[model samples]
Target: DVKVTQSSRYLVKRTGEKVFLECVQDMDHENMFWYRQDPGLGLRLIYFSYDVKMKEKGDIPEGYSVSREKKERFSLILESASTNQTSMYLCASTSGTATANTGELFFGEGSRLTVL
Candidate 1:
């Protein structure tokens, strides 16, 4: 089974602090994604990397960034944590477009961030 492991299940940060959320997948998937899920907005993509050292911005990439130096690992960085960025963050990965790019996304349990 493809498993995505997120570093934290919950976190608390102050405004302007830099935050890092790590994700690791054992499946060696080519595509990995970072997303933030909110109450009514559903899941909004923050960033995604299709290959090592390659990155792409998603719909809402304002306060977020990603790094994928290795096939099995990816990290999301918050340049400056803020109250508005508080939300449930999810990390996911797929075997790339061939498997099912638009299929159900395999998500981590999610990391809840609270900024004050």
Candidate 2:
């Protein structure tokens, strides 16, 4: 079974503070992603890493960055947290191999961040 674990289930930060959200997957999947869910904007991808040390910026990467130092772990960083950035962040992983890929994403419970 694929299990994605998030370090924090909720976070509260002030504006201009740097925040870090950590995620770890136990399935050894090659692809991991970060997304933010908002009321009107829906779920927007923030960043993704397909392999160790290789990352790709998603649609909304302006204020986010990611690090994939290991195959099972992916980290998302908020350079300067802001009130507008407050949202529910999700972490997901999937197999990268075409033959094993089912286009299904196994997701974590999510981390809700509040920036005040």
- Candidate No. with top lDDT: 2
RMSD of each: 1.6, 1.7
lDDT of each: 0.90, 0.94
Model 1: residue 36 alpha-carbon error in angstroms = 0.3
lDDT of 2 at 53: 98
**lDDT at residue 17 of model 1 (Cα atoms):** 100
TM-score of 1: 0.93
lDDT of 1: 0.90
Model 2 residue 59 CA deviation in Å: 0.5
Off by over 4 Å in 1: 97-104
Measured with C-alpha atoms, the lDDT of residue 58 in candidate 1 is 94
- C-alpha lDDT of residue 100 in model 2: 50
